[model samples]
Target: MIVKNEERSLERCLQSVQGKVGEIIIVDTGSTDQTKEIARRYTDRIYDFEWIGDFSAARNYALEFASSDYILHLDADETLEDPNNELMGNLDKDFYYIRIKNDLGTGLVLTHQFVRLFRNSPEIRYKGALHEQVQLDHNIHQYGYLSTLILHDGYKDDIIKSKQKAQRNEHILLEEIKNNPTAFNYYNLGMQYIVAGQYNDALNALKKSYTLANNYTFSQKVVLEIMKCLHELGRYQEAVKVSMDAVELYENIPDFWYQLGLSYLEWGMLKDAEDSFNKCLEIGEEKSQELLNHYDGTGSYLAQGQLAKVNLMLGNNEQALEYILSAAKAAPNVTGFFNIFLSILPNASPKELLQHVIHIWPYQTERHANLIATLYQQRHPLLNEFITYHNLDVEYPISTLHYIFENNYERALAELNQQSQKGTDHFITNNVILLSFLLNNPNLISEFKNDISLSEKEAKWFKNIILKKVPTQSIHVNKALLMIWKQLILDLIQLQKYEFIDLLISATKQAEFRLIISECLQQYGFDELALEVLIECDNSHVNRQVYMTAAKSLIKLGAAEDALFYLSKAEGVHLDFNVLFEKWRIASTIDKFEEIKILQKMIQSYPESRWAKRTSGAILG
Candidate 1:
């Protein structure tokens, strides 16, 4: 293994393969930490190599001491997931593709096969400076799959933040591109920028790589990255254009269909999205994993999970649940999948929710309990019974939620603040900011907001939400972040945080948005709070459903006059007689004879309609 400052994971990697391998060799380029000390515990063949800013150099130097005939290489951040000396004992190929599962921060995981195990031939030396590859150019390069898995945590958020390898690799790859411009090097640089969230630069580099790609071995992979970067940059049309070309040439690759589906989903073409995702499922898992930089289960569970979203937005809840259940069963540990569960079957009683979750994840590991607990936390009545039944200790965030549920906002805020200082979970940090504002502690709000990670869309949402300023952009939103705000709304209603809730309503501008908050408030018997939302809408009930909802809310609050006024403000949507009849009924009940007579004339416009005739006859009598 070639490593530098990998003390945190060096020992773990060595522990996985210590007894299995014939000999272990660790080459340290330069490490200020206890990496060498840790390496010595497993291998006496540890060598100190001078830092030359090239990974292949260090990797090749490490390989010089490997006495094994068939070599299986690993990095400091990688571990053999199973003690499979039996699997190792049966290697019979010139090279093998090792399955690597990468934890790419958040709940995102990607698994791909790479040429990590190969015969120790001189011609099979490493190539490239930064993103090195096995030199598989020789005629003897016959490769097959190795069943052994390697869990790689090199891209986990904490590790990425501490190591900042993305930045370093970006610089190195750029230099390599200048010196020797290979398609692979540009691809490497594009991937580096992608990890750094520079989607525009990534797209540029990936496009250049596409133009120079003489060999079509990883050409589909290049197209994938370019399309991915385009999607990230919100160039949906361009992404779909590229995706169309890619899927035509590489029709067998499920990822191309998946990418096409994502673009269609983003562009609001739900039918097209449904079609693309179905196509992906039909393609299923196939070969050439080593040729693509992709995720695990793209065609099967991943595609199903995405299909759940499409169906959810399409209002097919039952279909959505089926797809999600399949996905959750496959990867029950992913918390986001459960959130989607909550989004789909939100009305499921708490007991049913628990039972449904237990059905999906029968094993009560911490992962299973956490999924149940997380689902519970999003809704009401903290599930202490379930927690006790599972015999699991609650962790932070969830622990904080208990305090919130118990109406101990002060204690919750204190715990959240302390937790914010230690580490950051975006959800937890968002709650900390939320509680600060809800508690009328604006001073703590700024400090807490900075603790949470923000994507561009999310940053806008936070700024707009915190400022109690209505959003000016598209009403379509970021689902994960929207859930955070949804929780805040629920908290506001639960805790009777009326003033803050009003500010929240006052801050929002979208008609659909105002309607949602108002309707939520209205359903919970907060008509006044609902009014805080409805009163903010433009004086038009014709097109806007919110105005009609507002008029109904006002009637519930015994503001008949105000209700009639809202009902009469009809310009946007058609002035249906149902609305006019509602206004007439209110006017008659409130003893507004003159207003009723005027409404009778206005209702006569639709003379042939039953509602207009009823209004005219009622007024005449």
Candidate 2:
């Protein structure tokens, strides 16, 4: 083994192969840490070497110390997962490629088969300054893959960033490219830049490598790196073109198909994305290891996540849910799969999404619980079932809110009664108790009304929920009261209890609540009622979201004048792309030619904005 400053990992590496190997040898290249000291505990055959930029040189020097008939090479940060003497004895080949799992620390794992175990010979050596390759006479040497696996975490993001190891490798690779200008040198340089997040540099180097690459495997690696660079640069069209060319040449490689699917998704080609991702799944593992030698993990897991996204975009919620759940099952710790699942939850049917979340809850309870809590906080329907299914140890008030949302008022009251016995009397719990009293015994509000003290806003909200009355004047609202009020409003909406909505409207003077009420009404197909709610709210309120929502609702109700009024109110307070688009719609509706001139000026001011993109015919054209 060739090592430097690997004290942190040297012992573990030595221990993994302590009893399995006939002899151990360690060649240190100027380590300042206790690496050599630790190596002394395991082997007396430790040698010191001068610092050299070339990895192949150090590795070759290490090879001279091996006295065993067979040599197995490993880095300090890697460990032989399992070593079997019987398996080693059965191997008659001159060399064997062992599986290496590279953990990138961002939940992205790449798997590669590397020639690490080989028969000791004078002709066998190593090549390359960085990412050195095993060199041998393949015509005379027989090499095949083995079931033995090596776990490596040296290339993880944090380690790479902290150590700047990629930068160090880049220097060596640059020198190698200057001296040799080989396809392998350019490829190594490009990959080093990729690890360092220098995509443009990576792209230039990878393009050069592609020009010189002659071996099919080397060319495939070049194409994948080029596609990755283009994808990161947001050149989706170019990425798609390159990926298509790669797929035509390497149709059986799953990575190429997965890359094509990603590019097609970014380019808004849903059908093409679906077909490409499906091809990845259909191709399976045949020749996959050869094509994905430097990458870890199968494309199947990521392909499922992509398919989930594609199905969601195509409005196939059930299929999307199934695919995402399957992905979560395959890789529970993969944040990308969970992210896609969460993105679809807001649009999926509440009960269906809840059922799927429950199904996966047992696999990764903490992750699923956090997700369930987020959905509950968003007032997603059927949250009562989620809470009940998991028996979540959440606060009483939130659980009571879910029960109310599920229209199980009796169960809601039961939860309140159970929590009341605990003697916890916070504002939220007190408010929930009062809500339960009102739901179970409407005439008994006077009995419990004086027992709980609430802020003026909370009092107003409670009065509205209980008495169904609107406030006489607008007042500043507290955030906590607003959250509780919003959840209550969502519950009433789900139960189709519109009669209580009037009270909800009256309970808060904040334009935010009025906007929420307007949106809920609109969602329930009461466009005129939504407009009426928006019209009643003071337009002087400078919240951009409220103004934009009001403008849209007014325009939907054929009240262009009212829409323009709200849009104008949002002029300086929130001049974002959405607000700009709303202004354009108002201008088009009222035939105000001057307003179009203002829009042109606005688009020029924010040329990269989505509103500008739409108006300039750059997107969706």
Candidate 3:
């Protein structure tokens, strides 16, 4: 191994191979620290070499001192992991391809095979100044693959930052390219540019490599790097074109599809993104081994998880749900996919979510049941109104929670009817009340409100907000209960639970709440419901904003005459062009208002403006 100033990581690397290897060969390339002293703890076969600005030269020097038949190469930041000796103990081929895992410091391990173990002979020697590759006579080398991995710590962000390796690598690769000027050397320079985050430089070198390299030799890897550089540079169209050519050449590889999907996604070409990810899933199974050859999880979870986000953005909620659940199943140990599933879930009724759950994780395994229970255990939004609704008066989490978890109105309601007329458990009573509202049988709330386990303040909140048709001004709730109540209001709006929303409207006649509810409903296209709430907002005392909002919602419902009615009650309306024009437009539809009055108002407000000119031309032309 050739190293310089690797005191921090040298001892660990030496210890990992102390007992496993026959001899340790260390070649110091002018290290200013105690790296050689640390090596002395294990072996005294340490040799000093001058800094020649070429790694291959130092590595070749170390190769000359090895007395063993095979030379296993490693850097100070790299170590052979467990069960490594077994591979080293046997030798059927001239050399073996050892998998090196690069620690990206991103919770991701990148694996690539290299000819690190080989017979120590005069013919076998590493070439190139940086990112050197082992070369044999006439390029004829028998390489074998072993499952043993070498953990590399050099790529960690902190280590790279301290080492300033990108600058040094850039300098070496540029100097090497000046001398050799080969396709492989260009690819090396491109990789160094990428490490330096100089994407434009990477693209230029990689493109040159692509043009000069053989069709199949370096094209696959260079194409990938070129596409990545283009993506980073915001040249997505070029990236997609390059990726497509690669896909046609390597059709079954999941890596190309995965990369192409990212190209489309980052460009906001969502449909193409969706299609590419689906293709990854399709070819992932048949090409499972190749899928992991690059871009880990492309074959299993990455594409599936990413597809969930794409579908959600495209407004395909059901498809998004299926994709995310599939991602969770594919990577059950990865909590990130499940978190994506939660985030992608539509603000929908429990009945709507039940369909996706039943088919994905069937109730036989109790996984679907447990998943449903988990949501309710956290008391997530439950704004569903069956108008049809159950009673399992089971036990903190639920007797009614069980019924809700079942997500079955018929089964839950049947079970509830079988229970005694009144529930005995306190928390069960509270759930029964909530279930009653959820199931659209609000009358059941009266039967269980007395036995609810909620604190007295919570009871008053529940009664005043959900039960009594009075203003909530008199009740004082603590912060926690208030938060739950606010979430309930948001859920009711988001879920469009019209029946329960109507119940809340009747429970309080406060104009502020009515206006708030109306606005939220309109945001989700529930304009008719929004208009109804606005109508009950004490229109006689309401301002211009309420009147204008009500008129807009009325217009959406094709209620032009009623829109005029609300506009007629409008007060404190400023002489704005949009407001006046809308009122005039609606008024012109009916012969009810004097059009001349609005025409005069428009003319008088902005006599020298376009509004005045436009209205004047139409009025007197």
Candidate 4:
């Protein structure tokens, strides 16, 4: 196996392949750490290569360094499972098979396979910079699945390595796109954006790729990326279209069918969604049909597991449940299959389901917080179960806020106060924001005031998002914040809290929010009151609403020419009649009969609307 920067897992990897291969070769590519030192202990023919941007290049270089007729490559982050026994048993097999476990950052494991142990001939070489794959010249013969699996432990921590790598890769792809603009390069750039969590960029690149792609080589990939982007952007209908297009392109690929089913599920297309899921079940069953033909061999249980997943997505809880149980029974020792089985639910009691999940996957504590929320949604009394099973010492403030929203404020308050006693950082401040706005318990502002330390950025974020509803001392709470606070104050007037209005004007200490408060007063039938605030605005930097509000107020005050001046600032005659009413009033006062006729005609066009009635009254009066 070739290796680099593998000091953390090199020993386990080397020991796993021990006695399996006749010859061992270690290819190190520019290791600055103790990786080379540890690798030297395992093999005498340790070779080095200069680091290059292309992954396939490094992999091919490593392949050339190997002396054995067959080559098997493994990453530094992986360990061979039960390597000694499994390797010895499958050494002379006709076809190569490798078990790969995706150790994504969240600690979830998805196992797949690759044909890594292949003949060292020119017919096979690696391709692609990222997600490198071995290109085979001929069809596969007989293949064997090893009982042992590879343990991938790469993504234990949230690392910057992948993002840093993507930053460099995106540049290379940009250059390639300039010259070639191939569907494959765009698809690669899109995938890199996905890896870096840049969903918008991912969508742009993937959409361009999809439009340009005319062939199958990159069609499936382009469709999948576009579907994922639409899903992330909350365009569910668009996502469904992409998924359907993919299903039409590749009718047999179970993944595309499953995605189509999920899109339908999200859009509440229950019957059609279930049919799509059923297609996945049928296709997935056929995927594992070969196992039954070869009685002595293991089949692709992963595909079958996915079939169960699609069924679950379709809400066919019973049928999905059966598939998982049968799959687990077929491969009893596969822990991943058991976990999938535990996830199955029919019309089963919530308590029973939670009990089964916890009983079977007792060691899987990572999902406890999520399961707690899910159980609560199902109206299951699993709070104690969650706290006990997961040892969740941290307060889930957002979850508490949700509870308060459900009229469970007493319970929310209890959790928040308990967390405060524990002195956990950021617990009190976030809870206070939720309590003040969602629970409408202004007392939390005072209760948690001294305890909460709001940073300038955090304060600005809260002011922008949440405090618009509160709109009181939160200004003092987030000073030096420069967002225009006018409309926000106007919203407070609609909320009808006169005390909040006074507090807003006082806190702003500037004329901006006062002008907005004036608009609010006009909306509240206090047009005369609104005019006073408009006068304070300097009439220069105020927004469209400020002029509209001033026009309406001036019309109410019978200052027709002033109203006309303000109404003239409005861009078009097709504006809402609250503003047009002022314009019509001014036109009649000035005896501009033509403009008045046009305004009257507009009112007549929409006679039933409130704006029309106001316009007609202004014109006649």
Which model scores highest in TM-score?
Answer: 1
Query: What does candidate 2's lDDT look like per residue over 245-321, in tens digits?
Result: 88888888888988888877776556667888888889865557866464443457778888999998655767997
Could you tell me which 10 consecutive residues in candidate 4 have the lowest summed lDDT?
289-298
Sequence-dependent TM-score of model 4: 0.53
Residue lDDT tens for model 1, 271-291: 567788889789886632644
Clashes within 3 Å, all models in order: 4, 7, 4, 0
Off by over 4 Å in 2: 83-87, 292-299, 347-621
lDDT of each: 0.73, 0.71, 0.68, 0.59
Global lDDT of model 1: 0.73
- Write the candidate numbers in order of decreasing lDDT: 1, 2, 3, 4
Candidate 4 backbone collisions, by pair: none
- Across 135-174, the per-residue lDDT of candidate 3 in tens digits comes to 7532576767777778997877789889988888888988
- Where does the lowest 10-residue lDDT sum fall in candidate 1? 605-614
